[model samples]
Target: MVDARGLSCPMPVLMTQKAMKSKEDYYEVLVDNKTPCENVTRFAESQGYKVAVEEKNGEYLLKISK
Candidate 1:
């Protein structure tokens, strides 16, 4: 899991990017705000990942997979 909670836009996306370099089949990205969630979603999808977002208590969980 990429615990990006409390992080801002590019940091979250950048962290996710670094994780994705491992070439895994799945990733769980956690962010506390919508902007990071949305940015991560966009970046992941652009890389051919399927992103599914779940929200609870204002936190966003981005489930990214091939």
Candidate 2:
């Protein structure tokens, strides 16, 4: 699991990419903003991972399943 809140754009996705590279199972990424969440989701999709996103309490929760 990775919490990317308070991080700027691309950083969150970069971190997420790293996390995914180190894991062979599912991963969860938490971001405070929407743009990062969208970018991460798109990246996950492009990598052949299943992506799920939910917005709650002004935060975004992104789940990636390989």
lDDT leader: 1
Worst 10 residues of 2 by lDDT: 16-25
RMSD of 2: 0.9
Q: Against the true structure, whose TM-score is highest?
A: 1
lDDT of 1 by residue, 1-66 (tens): 999999998999999999999999999999999999999999999999999999999999999999
TM-score of 2: 0.92
lDDT of 2 at 16: 86
Quick one: RMSD of model 1?
Answer: 0.4
Clashes of each: 0, 0
Candidate 2 lDDT, 1-66, residue by residue in tens: 899999978899899888877757798999999889889999899988998898899899998898
For candidate 1, the per-residue lDDT at 48 reads: 98
